[model samples]
Target: MMLSARLLLAATALCCFATTFAISMDGFATGHKCRCLTTTSEVIPTRLFRRIEILAPGPHCGNIEILVTLKSNNVVCVSPDEKWIIELIARISRNRQQKKPEVFSADQHVLK
Candidate 1:
């Protein structure tokens, strides 16, 4: 009887370990979770900034993550995908393109 009891206890411990491993590996069997924090105000950035990333929904988690990298290397997430946000991103893209410095040929150089 004692031998049978020991086997039962070992089996129970093994089952518990397996359950924990599965949960941790699969993230509760659902998927990875993603959380994004965005500003509530509609105030867009004025200075030039990096690309406006468009994050779509996926197994990573619910909602999207819009990362707005600024000139100061500050990253801000703009959630809700609002019309104004989209427009703002477009404006930044256009401005960055226009801000590119023009390239000149070697013949144009006259160094003293």
Candidate 2:
């Protein structure tokens, strides 16, 4: 009985944590420019660029990241990394804005 109770508490805590982290995203940005030939410079040998955007309204948020990697002047690779990045960004933003970080335990159920 004690073991089951503990497991239940842990699961609840994990779910809350995941939910908070998941809904925390605010926004993100991405851009690319010409790469310099110098040793200490950033650039792309070919014509490539990247753009990313985050759209959040009230309780709902979404992120779209596009990478244009040019194999040739015309050929490119456009890929989306992961859905977690937006969440991570939002969490960071929230953390920064808040005076202190709040952590909740599953054992202490607080209904939202």
In model 1, which runs have C-alpha deviations exceeding 4 angstroms?
1-31, 89-112
Those runs of model 2 whose alpha carbons end farther than 4 Å from true positions after fitting are: 23-112
In Å, residue 101's CA in model 1 sits off its true spot by: 21
In order, candidate lDDTs are: 0.71, 0.45
Candidate 1 residue lDDT tens string, 1-112: 6999999999999999988887444356564666564454455655555666777887775576777778878777675557877777688789999999988897897669
* RMSD versus native structure for model 1: 8.5
Location of the lowest summed lDDT over 10 successive residues in candidate 2: 32-41
Listing every candidate in turn, what is its Cα RMSD in Å to the true structure after a full C-alpha superposition? 8.5, 21.7
TM-score of each: 0.45, 0.22
Checking candidate 2 for backbone clashes, the offending pairs are 25-90, 35-43
lDDT of 2 by residue, 11-97 (tens): 999999998888523333223221221221133332233332342223222323333334443323222344444454576679888
lDDT at 6, model 2: 96
